[model samples]
Target chain A: MLEIKNLKASINNKEILKGVDISIQPGELHAIMGPNGSGKSTLANVLSGKDGYEVSGELKYQGKDLINIPIDERAQKGIFLAFQYPTEIPGVNTNNFLKTSLNKIKKARGEKEMDTLSFIKMIKEKSNELGMNENMLSRQLNVGFSGGEKKKNEILQMKILNPNLAILDETDSGLDIDALKTVAKGVNSTRDKNKSFLVITHYQRLLNYIKPDFVHVLADGKIIKSGSMELAEQLEKTGYKGIN
Target chain B: MLDFKPNEKEIEKIGKFSIEEKNFRIENLKNFNSVGFPNKLVEDWKFSDLRHIVSKNFAKLDLKLKPSKEENFDFIKDFEHNYIVLVNGRLTSNSFQHEDNSQIVINPYLNKDFSNKKEKNPLINLNYALSIEGFNLEVKDNYKFNKVLVIYNLFTKDLNENILNSQNRIKIGKNSELHVFDYVINKSEKNFFNNVYEDLYLAESSVFKNISIQKNRSNGFFHKFSKNILSSKSNYSSFIFPLGLKFDKLDLEFNLEGENIECNLQAASFLNKGDHQEIKTRVNHLAPNCKSYQKVKNVIDLDSKGVYQGKIFVKNIAQKTDAYQLSKAILLDESSEFDSKPELEIYADDVKCSHGSTSGSVEKDSIYYLMTRGLSKNESVKLLINGFLSEIIVSIKSKTMKNFIEQKLLSQIYEH
Candidate 1:
């Protein structure tokens, strides 16, 4: 569902992703583990078409050119990226924003819009599943949400939109044991045979909940190694130095 | 009216005219000379230079033009209560309609004995001397008016006209409620100057909401001064929206005279090229346990300039007072300038007073975020600007006013 061919990206004249290549098919989950300066987040940003980057090389999603699509269009095409630091939009309610985003995606897909009552009901149900209270939906989007709450909120958005490809960037960094499980459960529930995920993290804690079908070690802005789920356990036991 | 000659004869003649018209003119001139215009020399007005607009000769407008009722007056024609019409600072008796229960007091300056009190400022003295007509409204105690009170100030151009001045006074009785909608509409293309002074007195337990809409011509200059006095347990709120004018200045002052009084002032303005707008407000807490809140927002495009100066003062005896003031402005272009100064003067140590002022361009990250969501850059900027000003726009109690403001903001963004 997603492909990156020799993806070269730089921010502020500093090359972050140097000729990185990766691929994932439908119904499969891939984990990219790397050290601090290994350009994991940069890869996610380039895939999502975020601004402020000089990128080169071809990126294709579902047999279409993905490098030129706007971020919102990418989102409409079922490409979702859970940001490491979600923005706080004051005075904008979470439910309203979610409805707007969901309707945009639906409209792009030539689907009918949900009525107000049904929309509220859907939000209530999804929020309940994610252990989010009703008041959180009415509050301003992420104005004062805790670290774990923001991550869960991102996952809730993903579930609502039902994106084709979900990119989780450092979603488990700030989560406690309970929050980690809740977020993992939310992500796991949204998994389908047509949906794929690119889980980017430095640790294997999140992998325990949503097990990856493939594991890859990213170093020096390139995928130096790739293997099955056992590679994750081996890295967890010996760290990145053992493979490098 | 004095001639343009800088001779003692002209000054003496105008001085005599001022004394006969307003008894407090001489005392006001003394104070005006003492304080002058607070410029770089004065710390309080350091950020704002009033010297350019002040310290100059303003012609005394003559009440000669007759009232012309031509346009559709649907906004205020159906009111059952009494109303007054001011045309070029001249009050017209034939144009006004009065009801049985409503009494229209015209030209209060002719009946009430005028005095020169030490507390009276120079601007008040100038207005008192030059005001053509004053409307005194006294709502009966415990009286409830089913209709709204509407006052219209219509300006027209005449041959060789320079300026116009008007003043109005309103008083609401105890347990009475009043809604005053003041409209300033300009119909001429002349370079006109309008100076309006409004004084509102709210009795104990009285409630009053005043909404002022300025829809003047593009070439006209408007200066409005409003002073409100709130009695014990009275509630006073005002919303000022200035949309069409080349230069506009609004000076609003709220005096909390009695305990437990509440006052709220919200203002918004949108300016385009060569348009200058200024909103200056002062809230004085004289009694204990008073509350005041002020919010002002402005959007400037191209070479336009917007200014906001808000001051909150808590007296020594005004303990336990809660006061909050905020002023923010967004400049769309690099040439546009926004100046904001929020000041808090507290003599009471136990009072809770806070003031904040901010000026900047729209957040670039926010724009990128919205653009990524499929909205164009312009759409994203408009949405963020709307959110920035929504804090004050949503507080407007009138739905019509709220929608009008929303439309105006959208149009401004489109034009930019």
Candidate 2:
């Protein structure tokens, strides 16, 4: 469902992703493990179509040219990225922002938009499942949210959007044990036969809840090794220094 | 020194008015000289330099012929109520259709021998002596008028180029409610001047909401002043929305004379090109336990300029006064500029007063974020600008006025 070939990317005239390659099929869960400065976040940013980066590569999603598509177009094509640091927009309620974004995505996909009542109902249900209180939806988006609350809020958005390819970029970094389990449960409920995920993290603790199908060792912006779930267990025991 | 003198030919042309108006003009000129436009030495006019804008001769507009219904002064075509229409500076006969229990009074200046009070400002004296007509509208006590009172000030052309001097007085009796809409629409293309004065008196327990819409032509210059006083337990709300004009200045003063009175003043202006607009407001809490709120917003593009000066004063006797003032502006281009000054003077120790002023351009990071979401640069900028201005529009209590402002903002967006 996703393919990257010899992808070279740079930020501020400095190369970050040097000839990186990855491929994932439908229903597959891929984990990319790397140390600090291994270009993990840069990879996610490039896939999301953020500007200010010089990228030269061939990226295809379901046989479409993904590199040239805009960020919102990528989102409309069922691509979602859970940011490690969510933005805070003051004076804009979370529910209103989500409704506007969701309607735009639905309109782009030629789907019917929900009315006010249905929209409110959907938000109430999803927010309840994520353990978010009713008042959180009425407040400004992430204006004064705690660390754990922001992560859960991102999970809530992912569940509402129901994207085809979800990229969880260190979503478990700042979450507590309880929040981690809750977030993992939310992700597990949305997993389907046709959906895929690319989980990027430095620690393997999150792997205990959402197990990976395949684990790839990424170092110096290149994948050096690939194996089954056991590879994650081994990395957890011993750091990336010996494996590389 | 700036050249503040008016052209000799222009003064000679305006000398053809009726003998009464000519005499009034001479008296106003003498008064104007004594109180010439306050210079930078004055505190209130510190930021605004009036000498550059006010003419030397400053002739008063002549009273034109009586206006008619065909001139489109009727706000609601099918709906009927007491309506007064003023063209130039003359009140047309049969212009107002008075209903039962409502009194229509015009030109109180001639009826009552009232002297001009001592106001350090010269403009007050000039406006008093050269007042064309004063509208005295009274709604009977305990009477509920579901219809709105529309005062249409239409500017039409005349052979002589002179300044328009108009005054309006409105009184709401005790326990009465009324919705007053004052529209300043200019269709003239000549170099015209306007001086408008409005005085509102709200009785005890009465409710009054005034909305003023100014859409002047490119060649028009306007100077409008309004004073409102509220009685005990009364509610007064005022909104000023100015759309198009070359140069416009508005000065408003509100006095809370009774305890537990509620007052709100909101003004918004959108300008483009070489247009200039200024708004100055002062709210005074003279009674105990009074509440006042003020919000002023402006959006300027091209080479336009805007000025906002707001002041809140709480007297020593007025304890428990709660007042808040905010002034915000957004400049869309490098050539555009905005000047904002917000001041709070409190003599009471128990009063709560706060004022904030902010001037900024559109957030580039927010624009980039929107653009990354598949919107073009123009669309992103327009969306952000709309969101910024809609903060004031959403606060409007009238749905019709809100929709009107939305349409105006959209048109401005498209034009830019």
Candidate 3:
């Protein structure tokens, strides 16, 4: 589903992601485990088409150029990135934002947009499954939300969007046991043969909930090793430095 | 050294009007003679350069004129409200009337009497000099208005440059509730000058919501000054929306006369195509336990300029006064400009007062976040701006008026 070859990226004339290569097939759940400053987050950001980055290399997704398209175009092309720190928009309603986003994608896919009633019903159903309260949908986007609530809100969006490829950037950090389970359950419900996921995390705790098909250890801006789900357990016992 | 002189054309224009009671009119006109329509030299007129804009043209008193043709505003058709139409500063037809049993009275204000009031502004003095007709509204105690009262101040096609002046006074009795809307729609090509003054008095425990909308299509110059007085336990909420114009200025003053009063003043201005707008505001915390909040937002495009100057004063006796003021602007391009000056003068040490002002372009981070949600750059900026200004609109106490102004606001943005 995705291919990256010698993905070199830099910010402010300082290189962050050195020559790196990775490949993910359809229906495969991949996990990238790394320590601090190991370019895990940088890779997610570069793939999502964020601004202020000098990137060069061949990055393709679904047989199309990923880096050349705009951020919104990439989103319309079924790419979703769940941020580690979601922004708080003080005046934009959560439901309205989600609706606008869904309509954008639906329009691009030549699918009919959901009416207000159907949209509300669908959002309510998904939000209930994600354990999000009714009042949270009317509130401002991430404004004054608790740490766990913000992550759960991200999960709610992911469940509603149901994109072709989802990138979870530290989605499990700062979540309690209950919230962690809720996020994991939400992700597990959406797993299918046509969808792919690239989960980035610093700990092996999140892999325990939703098992990965391939686990890659990222060290110093490059993937050092790739193995099965046992590689995650290996890293939990022996840290990233211990493996090198 | 304040040197004031009146121009010859202004004097000639004043002579054209036949005055029965020349004493008050001449005195007030003489007061305007000394000030000569406030210029940049005046402290209050520093941001609004009214003298330079209207000095070359004279406000004519042409009585030999035909009634203006009817104007059809598209948004007005979608809503149902009582309408009082005025064209070229003349009352055309009013389908709405004050309730006789409800103690609400509406009449033409023809009072030439001058009072020893507190506000001493040159424009008010000019309005006082030319004010022969306007609406005087009064509501008695415990009366609640069931319908929204809309005053459609329309400026239809005009062939001459006229000076249209209006004076309005609203007095709400104790425990009364009223909602009023005043909208100005200009469709003429002539560059006429409009001067309007509003005096609002809310008795103890009364609630009043006032809204003003101004959309000047042609190159017109408009100015409005609203002075309000609030008593104990009374609440006064005022909202103003100015979409686009050639030249516009609005000044609002709130006097907290009694304890436990609340004043909310909000406004939003969207200007482009070299339009200029100035908003000057003042809130005086005279009594203790008073609360005041002021939120002003502006979005400037092209070479348009916007200016906001607000001040909050807490006296020594006014302890425990809570006053907050915020003014923010979003400049779309390099040519557009915004100037904000917020001031705080407090004599009480135990009062809670804060003021802040910010002017910047749209944040790239916010745009990127919205973009990642599948909204394009243009859509992202528009949505963020709508969110920014909608906060003030949602604060309105009247649902119908809020929805009305909100629809006008959205349509204005989308039409571009």
Candidate 4:
């Protein structure tokens, strides 16, 4: 469902990712483990089509060129990125924002838009599944939200949007054990043959709940090793420096 | 260019007046004629530069009142309340169906008080000299209205290159409560200038709330100077949404003359191309234990200029005075400009006073975040702008009023 080869991305002439390659098939969940400054977030941003990045080499999604697509178009094509730190947007209601985003994607796909009643009902159901307070959706988007609440909000958005390729960039960071489990459950429920997942993290804790099909160790802008769940277990015992 | 300076003979043509009133008008006229219109040289008019703006836009400034074209009034269907209709700055009709008629008094304003000191503002001087139309409203003591008072300030289609000056006075008695909505609707097809002077007084323990807004876009050059006085324990709050005019300025002054008085002022506006607007306020804490707050926000687009000058002053005897002022602006284009001046002067050592001003283009990260959610760049910017300005609107306590204002403000942002 997604492919990248020799993807060298730099910002302001400072290279962050140098010749990285990764490929995932439909229904597969891949976990990328790395230490600080290992370009884990950079890879996620480049895949989401964020601006101000000088990227070269091959990057394809669904066998189509993904490099030239704008950020919104990428999202319209079923690509979603759960931010590590969701923006605190004051005066924009969380429910209203979610509805707008969903309707935009729907309109782009030539589908009928959802009305307010159905949108509210769906949001309540999804938020309830994530164990979120219904009151949070009525407040300003991420403004004054707890760290865990913000993370769950991102997951809830992912579930509502229901994208094909979901990239979770450190969605486990700043989350407690309970929130981590809830986020994992949210991801696990949406797993199907046609959907793919890219879980980026520094630790293997999130992988304990949402088992990954493959594990890759990214260090110094390159992936040095690739294996299965055993690889993540080994990295937990020995630090990233202990890798070959 | 045609002469804007009015001759002394024009004063006599307005109406018959006492010798003292005639002299007062002539003195103010002289004050205005000395400086045809305030330019950049004047301290308060520095950012506005009215002389240059007038010279560029108007060839002649007619001081004669024109007959109204008799257009049907469009009352707001969103809510029901009392209304006072002013056609071309002249009080045409009024209704008080929602209140006790005996507790309220309304009349046409005839400025007979000639005991005030000479004014410094040329525009005020011009208004005092030429203004012959407006309203005078008084609420009885210990009475609260059952509904909001809607003041419909309407301009007719017959006004072209004309100037209209009017004065309004509102007095809230002791222990009384009043709420007002100053709604302006203009249908003039040609350019005209409007100058207004408003005098308001809040007696002891009175509560007064006001909201001012424009109904639509118009070819009007508008200016209003409001002077407000608050007595002991009186509370006053004002919300202004002044938009869709070629040039508009609101010069407001509030004086807290008694202890434990509360004063609040907030304004939000969206200025599009060729629109120039200014909100200048001076809040004076003359008595002990008074608190005042002011916040102004603006979203300015291309070729539009927005200015805010707010000042707070505390007297030496006014201990425990709390004053705060903040101004925020987002310029949508490089050519759009915003100027803010916040000043605080405190003579009381125990008082807490602070002021802040910030102006910048919209944050790129915010736009990118919204765009990532499947919104186009234009939609994202509009959403951010609406969100930024709506912070003030969210503070309104009435849900019905808040929803109505939200719809109006949303359309203003989307249309731009």
What's the candidate order when arranged by decreasing DockQ? 4, 3, 1, 2
In DockQ, how does model 3 score against the reference complex?
0.72
Q: Sort all candidates by TM-score, best to worst.
A: 4, 3, 1, 2
Candidate 4: CAPRI quality band:
medium
Candidate 3 at residue A18, lDDT? 92
Name model 3 segments beyond 4 Å from true: B1-21, B33-35, B55-83, B95-98, B115-120, B215-218
**Pairs of colliding residues, candidate 4:** none
Error of 2 at B283 (Å): 2.1
Q: After TM-score superposition, what is the CA distance of residue B101 in candidate 1 from its true location, in Å?
A: 4.2
lDDT of 4 by residue, A4-115 (tens): 8999999999999999999999999999999999999999999999999999989999999999999999998999999988888878888899999999999988889999
Candidate 4 Cα outliers beyond 4 Å, as residue runs: none
Q: In terms of TM-score, how similar is model 2 to the real structure?
A: 0.77
CA-based DockQ, model 4: 0.80
- Candidate 1 lDDT over residue span B239-264, tens digit each: 77777677677778889999999898
Instruction: Give chain B TM-scores in order.
Output: 0.82, 0.85, 0.88, 0.98
Query: What lDDT tens digits, residue by residue, belong to model 2 across residues B1-416?
Result: 43333222333343355555555555555566565666657666665556655443234444232432435443644344455666664555333444444433344322133433445555665565455664566665775566666667677644244555667677888888877777666667666666677788889988998777764435677777878989999999877877777777788899999999999888777778777788888898999999999988888889888988888999999999999999888898899988888888889999889999988887766654454343456766676676666667778877776776677666766676
TM-score of 3: 0.92
Q: What is the lDDT of candidate 3?
A: 0.81
Which residues of candidate 1, in runs, are more than 4 Å off? A64-69, A76-78, A102-131, A176-182, B1-19, B22-64, B73-113, B116-130, B143-162, B179-191, B213-220, B396-416
> How much lDDT does each candidate structure score?
0.74, 0.75, 0.81, 0.91
TM-score preference between candidates 3 and 4, better one: 4
Q: Model 1: share of native contacts present? A: 0.30
